[model samples]
Every structure is written in structure tokens, then in C-alpha cells.
Target: MLTFFSLVAATLCVSASDSTVELTTFNAGVLAGVPLWRERMPFLLSELPNSTADVLCLQEFWLETDQLAVVNATSDAFPYHVRLETHPSATPPCDATPLQAGLVCVQTRCPSNDSVDQILCALLEENCRSELRAMGQRCLNCLVLGSPNTGLLNDPLSCAVDTGVSYSTTNGLLLLSKIPLSNTVADGYNIATGEIDIYARGYLSAEVENLGTVVCTHLPTPNADRLDAPYFGPVEFNSIEEQQNAYIQQLMNRYSSKSPLFLMGDFNHGPAIGDTVAAEFPQVYQNVLDQGFVSPAETRVGLCTSCLDNSLKSTGSANVFIDHVYVQSQHASNVVDAKRLYEAVLPIGVPLSDHYGISVTYGIPVAEDPIEEWKTAFTAWKDAFREWQKNEEEC
Candidate 1:
């Protein structure tokens, strides 16, 4: 059997020969929090073979022992290195919990003595045990939200809410790769204020060597406003917007002059692509475009409203492209084809996640084009995508 370390070595070898790489992003849909959609995860993983991406960024991935096992089994084809976001809370319960209700999972098959099962088990056990224990403790604390009691009560149901529930955590984001991840950092972005508040949202960044730098992020959702907004609660719009812009600015400042950069994630808002409240967040999307970044999925798909549920009448109207993958303009020559995967299709066997996955392919030429570099880039991108489809069939 091919060991995990060997898979990484193979990817490095492949990287050496290729001038361009493809980056794919997906919102795996909160795996652990919602039990109903859990079974459909395997089919989602099977859909995106490792051969299709050098790096895969996922949003809303809840990492736990069982969920990690499914990831390991489904991702066997892509043997590569992987990385996950760290928790944001500094305190025991919150800090001990994984970052975001969403956790980012990245993998790159490399050569090693550790079997896939062994490595996966170790990582899952460590992460799941810590997170679950923290969550259990938090649930215990939330029981006292409005109660006058200060000490731990003997009855667990004494402070329970109307629903008789205490704690609730959701999946955040994930990143998987076929190459090693360097300089990984996780921070949060408040869309309302555009600030990198290490307390809420989480961000992860790393150098991909030949691929320059790739950053994976999971921003705060509007759900937070329901709890804190005044009229509706605290509309974290400003904070969320500010942080989104800040993250882009930080990326440009750090690597603008070095190499190409790609930022992928679930922004939780739909800009001009669709008629949604999120579409109003022009500042964030503008920053990305201004930074010489283009969203391949948006350019090709055009206002994707893939998220649908038969149970609802507004199924089609709810369509919007919230998930995205951005690539630098200079590297435009390498793009082969860019489009969204799993658009309207429900996750695996069930309606798991609320969003779909987006992907983009790039083909670096043996020689640079003297003119119309984009034309050459598109041609190669098309060819690469075809090859990818063929590989998927074989797999």
C-alpha cells in the first residue's frame, strides 16, 4: 500500500514538472453539527478525486473522530499533506474547541511510514476528544446564561432552555492539499467592521512553494447578529466587511511582490452575483478584483444559485454563488477552466450542506505567450479540465 509520506513525495515530483496547478474549493457542509446529512459526505468526497486538485479548500467542516474517518476513506485517492484551522477562543472551553463551528481540513498525499488509517485516527482522536470535551463543558456553562446560580448544579436539566438544549456548535471551514503547507495562520474576520478579530472568525494561510501562497478562510455568518443585534440584534455587517477587506489587504502587502496568491472560502454573503443581502457586500469583492484577482467559478458559471431544497418553494430563487476561488491576474496565463461543481445537486445521498462546491483549473505553458496570454491560458485550461474529467471517470 502507498504510505501517506510517499504520496507527498509524488506530489512534489509532479509539481516540479508542471508549471501551473489547479485549486478547488468546497463547502463540505457542517458535517458533525447536523446529523441528518452525515451519510452523504462520502459521495461528496468521491466526487472530487485528488487528481483534480493540487490544493482543496473546504468550508464548514466539523472535525471529529467519525467525520475524520470518513474524510480519510473518501480522500484516499489524493494522498497528500493536510492542515486545519486552530480554535479562536483563548479560554479553556472555547480555546479547547476547534476553530469556527467550521473547521478547515487540508490534505496532500506524501510518503511516510504512517498508514492513512493510522495518521487519520491519531489526528481525529486528538482533535475530536479535545473539541467534544470542551463542547460538553460549554454546554454545561451555557446552562447558566440567565440563571442566578453560580455553582455547578446537580441537575443537568435545571437550566435547560425551552428546547431543553444547552450547547450548540457548528462546522467552520477546511483546506486540503497535495503539497506541504508552510506559514499556516488562523484568524477571524468580522465582516461588519472588516477587522481581523482573533475572537470570532478564523483564517489559515500557508506557502505552497511553486503555487505561491494560498489562504483559506471561514468568516462569521449573519446568524451571530440574531443573538447580539439590537433591533435584529448586532448587525455584524460592518465588522464582517472590514475583516474581509483587511484579509485581502494583508495578503497583498505580504506577498503582492513575491508570487501569485489564491484566496478561497465561504464568504457567507453573495455579492453582485445574486440578489441577496450578501450581494450588498461590494467592498469585499471589489477588494479582491482590485488586487488583480479573478474568480474563475463566477466568470464561467454566472450567478450560480445551486443551493436548493425541495421542501421549500423558493428553491431556485435561493440560488447564489457564495463560495469562491480567487487567483492572481499575473497567473491568468495558467488557468485552464473554472466552474462550480455540485451546483444544484444535493450533497451525496441527502441535502447536507446549504452551499455547493466551486473549482478552477490552470495549465502553465512550456513557454510564455508573446501576446494575448489569457487566450493561451484559456486553451490550456480547457485541455486540463478535459483531462481531469477523464481521470475522474477512470477513478
Candidate 2:
């Protein structure tokens, strides 16, 4: 019992070492058909291997091909990576069409011999979509946008199908590291944002040898509140955001002892004090701040990642400092540098992305902790031991 207590006390004490990590977080605005994506995406992909940043937490790399391109390009230099594939908050136009006002591509998938009225009523639904998807691009286009542009596949006889999802948009988050990373895992929020788990906007995190866990994620826009919660006046977070913050808190409790825990990505809201927009609508940003991760400090305050000054920024893009990088205060010893990246056009005659990137250079304490699985077992034992002692004392 004394030995167990000694180990518990030892676990409480953490020693810090000096090991610096340079991480850059960027929102690569590569939305398809959006302005300049075609030009900017190819350029970014071609030059990603050349990036000197030690770690990259990127958002909006929307397509599977784009994600693979970076993985392949940086295979040698930045060898390790995690695809933080968040689910799209909004689904594609597949569910409805402009042609029909309150209905989805007709209605149901009927047989090839169905009558004309039945065929017209049968929109490219569950079974219809599968059949339409296999009918080649012309027909696949109909399956995708719910528009039979050619009007050729509108007939039930020409219906088709496939389960592949490459044609649609995903959450578009990615992480890359030159340093070795282990226990790569993707986690989604248990409480649904906007009342649906399908909006897979969650997080991806992994272990960095003796350093700490690095996480990347993209929070949704504030207006899209979680539908499951009751309204209790103007609260800081909708139940979903509270759940999101709690998840981060859990990680800090789990790892700040072992090393600096980094939470980096597009928070979709700016710093409450520095950015005017965020100060006006502070709830989204404030909820995260309450989590207690080390902020970038006042020095980097007011820096707008998605500013209109960037030539590549889309029209009506809010000028706010949403993209961020933060570590737990206990591990504040880790931050050696904090700055923004790619404000202007690069050597390739184009901007790296629509939104500027954030770079954080920090030192990692080299004292190693047990890997996740072992740590979980040990923590369980420690908790159980503590509880048993409490009951014995009560008796």
C-alpha cells in the first residue's frame, strides 16, 4: 500500500526537459468550384514536401485525392500523418433538387418496367442512387447533385448504384509530422452537433514519443447549435460545444502531466479580447478559452488568419483570427515561438491558401510516460486504489 501511494505521488510529479517542436496549422481553402481552388490547390500540393515546418495541422483539404496527394508528396520528408476526417456539417445537394420544390429526386427506386408516373416519382433515392452511380459520369453526375443534367437517367430503366463516398465533401482536416507519431486515432463527439452525429466534426490526435499528444480539429460555425439541448438562456456553449470543451479537458487531464498537450485548428471563432468580431460574438471562442490551454499570448493577438487582405481570401470571408495553436499552461515551457504563415503570395505566384497559417515552435519535455493502453490500465488501478482507501477510512 505504501509502494502504491509512492507510485501515485511520483505520477503527480513531472519533470520538464528541453526539446523544441515547430508546428504549423493552416486552413487550405480548397473547396471545389470555389474561387481559385484549382490554381491554389495544385500549387499547394506541389510544394507541400518543401515545407520546413515540423508538424502540420491543416483544415479544408476537402477531397480524398487532395489528402492522398499531400500524404504521397511528403512521404519521405514528413513521414507520419493523420487524416482528421471530420464529417461535413452540411450534406451535399444529393437530398433535393431545384426542379422539385419539396421532394428529393422524385421519390423511390422503382423497377425498370415501372410506369412513367412511377418512374417520375422515383427520385434517385437509396436504391436508385446506387444504380445511378454505376452508370458512368453522365449518370453519376445525376446521382451526385440530384440533377439529371442530361435528363437521360430520369427514367427508371436507366437507374444505377455504388457505395463509394469520394464524390462528396468530408470535414477536410489533416495532420502531418516530421517527428515519429504513434497511436494515431480519430475520435468524434458523443453529443451530436446540430443534432446529428453524421456531421462528423470531431478530432484526431496522436502521441509524439517523449513530447505529448497533438490534436487537430475544425469546430463548426456558431449558428449551427446542437439541436438536442434545452435552451437555458444565452449560455456560453450549446450542449455540443460544452461537450467539445469537455473532451479537450479530458485530454489535458490525461496528458499535461506527461507533456505539453497541443490543441490546434480552425476554431471558427476568434479571440474574445483582441479580435473585434470575436469580442462581439464571444461564446464560441470563449468556450474553448475556458478549457485552459495555453494561449498564444498577447503578442500574436489580433492576427487575422482569414482576413480580406489576402488576395486568395474569398469574398465575404470574415476577417477573424480563428485558426489557433495552444498548449496546456503546465507545459507552457514548450512554446519557443508563435507566428503566422503565408500572408502573401508564395514563389509559385499564388497564395498557399485562402486563410493564413499559424506557426508555433515549442519545446517538449522528454520525460516519457507509459503509452496510452498501459497508461489507461495504470490510471484505472490508481483510481480504484484511491477509492478503496476512501471506503476503508469511512468504515
Candidate 3:
């Protein structure tokens, strides 16, 4: 008992020291048909590898092919990656005509018995399909031609289906770590998500060696009316936002530990203080702040995360902040420095994404023995809980 108490004392006495990891979060705009995506995506695709980030959290990585492209490109720098593959169920067949329109043609149309294969082959053409297939692109996942079984093109009777998500783009939350990661957990919100529920917006958590647990997520937009953008009373949207924030807190409790707990992603809301547009979703960031998560961007002046409107094509004349990063203050982690990466390509000055990327370097204290350190942390946590309980009773 004395030894255990001593260990607890050691844990409590642990001080913040120098240990840093650079984390970057960016919303890489969807792959849907848009002129801005056409112009900027290529640049982003090339530049991400060169960017300096120990860990990268990306949102709006629409297609499986695009996900693969990122994984393959950064195989050297970020060998470890977790994608929250959060897409709506395909119980109903998929309609992919919209995606088909912009595809590069390889050969003249060919006749095939397979309804799905025929549409995919006609859309992709022979050469282009074959090439994209070689790159592991499949019909249902993107514009490439691969297998008919998973492509939603197999049914011989019909070719019609809904196009909201013609193919599976998933929830668009992806995490890439230079260090090895394990015990990944991901899911969409349990509450009703309304119109954009099909997107399956959710959080992804992974345990990184020495870094404790890191969570990457993209919450659903606060507006219940995604299509019309009608301004309903705060009660409708705020309630949903609060529920989502509670869910996020539950995740942090489930995944976080004695080491640093870092949360990075597009919360669809800005920092607590600035920007009128992001102010609309106050409950989102406020909940995180209430939980003792610290953000460096909150302190800086004139901080804006979003450069473009929701459409992802046009630029915004007014400043709008949304993306955010939160680090747990209870842990033995300290921020070395934090900054935002604004990717503005020269000549046209077109930003690589609709949202600017935020990165933070965190410093963690090292202990001599890993096992003892964990035990000490566990004891400290228990003691704190008991102390809180005692205080509650006194109150």
C-alpha cells in the first residue's frame, strides 16, 4: 500500500518537460464535380507529401481512390494511417451517373450483358478503366472500372438509383501517423442526423505509441436543413450540436489516457471567441473547451480557418473560422508552438482547400519505466475521481 501510494505521489509530481509531435488538420474539399477542385486538388495531392506534419488529420477525402492516393503517396513519411470508412449502407442500389460525367474516356462505347459493368465500362472507356483499375480504382468507389460485385452495377434489371452518394465516399475522416497506431475506433453519431445523415459524419480514435490516444473527427453541419439552409431557431440546431459534443466527450473519456490526448479535425464550428459565421454553432467548441481541451488558435488575432464558402468553389469575401485542434490540459503535455498552413498557389492565388490547415507541436514528459508510469497514472486518475466525489458529498 505504501509503495502504491508512493507511485501515486510520483505520478502527481510528474512535471511538463520537452516532448513534441506536430499534428496538422485540414479539410481537403470533396471530389465532387467542381472547377475549384479541378484546379487545386492536383496541387494539394503533390504538396501534402512535402508538408511537415508528424501526424495529419484530413476531412472531406471523398473517394476511396483519393484515400488510397494519399496513403500511397505518403507511404514513406506517414506509414501508419486510419480511415473512418463511414459511408451509408448500400442496401439500396447506388446511382453513379454524376460521377460518370467528368470521367476521362478511353475507347468508344462497348456492349456488355452486365448492367453495372456496361455502365462503368462505357463511363470509363476501355483504356482509362484498365489504367485506373491497375491503380485499384473500382466503379462504385469512384470513376474507375474494377469488379462488378462491389460496384453496385451488377443488377441486370435496372440502372436507376439515388445519387446523393452515388458511390461510397465515407465520412471523410482520415488519420496518418508517422508513429505506429493501434486500437482504432470509429462510428457515426447515434442521434438523428437529418438530411446529411447519409454522410455518416463521425469520429475516429487511435492509440499512438507514447502519444496516448489521438481522435480525428468531422461533426455533421449544425443546420438540420442542409439543402435549403433555412434559419431555424437555435433550439433545433443547438440541441443536435450539444448532443454531438457530448458524444465527442464520451469518446475522449473512452480513448484518452495518462499521455497526451489530442483532438484534431473540422468541428464545423470555429474557436469560442471570433468570427460571426462560426459563432452560429457555439455549443460545438464550447463543449470541448468546457472539457479542459486547449487550443492555441483561440489566442491569435484575426484567426480564420475557412477561405471559401460551403460550396467549396467560390472564395469568401468575409472571414469565417471553423476548423480546430484541442489538446487535453490534464495530461503531461505542453504546446511547443502552433500555426496554420494556408496553401495559396501563386499566379491564380487559389487556395488548395476551402479550409486552412491547423498544426500544433505538443511536448510530453518522459518517465523511466513504462509499466510503473502507467500504474502511477492509473492511481492518480482514481485518486482524483475520489477527491471529486468527496468534494461533491461535502457540497
Point to the candidate with the largest lDDT.
3
lDDT of 1: 0.50
Q: Give per-residue CA lDDT, model 1, range 224-313, as digits (tens).
A: 222122111122323445545555665566557756778788765555664532253566777778779887776677655335442211
Judge candidate 3 at residue 227 and give its lDDT.
21
Per-prediction TM-score: 0.56, 0.61, 0.62
Which candidate has the highest TM-score of all?
A: 3
Instruction: Residues 1-395, candidate 3: write the lDDT tens digits.
Output: 23444545655775545667888888887544233554565676788888788888998776665677778888888888888653533422323443333232322354555433343343223233333233222223433121122332243212224333334456667898898998887665533232223234667778888877788888655432332232121123334465466557666666655346778898776653544443636656777777777677666433667654333545334455677777886742467777878656534466677778888877766655767767767878788667656666776
* Residue 91 miss distance in model 3 (angstroms): 9.7
- Which 10 successive residues of model 2 have the least lDDT summed? 144-153
Reference-based TM-score, model 2: 0.61
After TM-score superposition, what is the CA distance of residue 369 in candidate 1 from its true location, in Å? 19
Estimate the overall C-alpha local distance difference test score of candidate 2: 0.58
Off by over 4 Å in 2: 1-17, 84-169, 190-199, 222-259, 272-281, 315-318, 346-350, 365-395
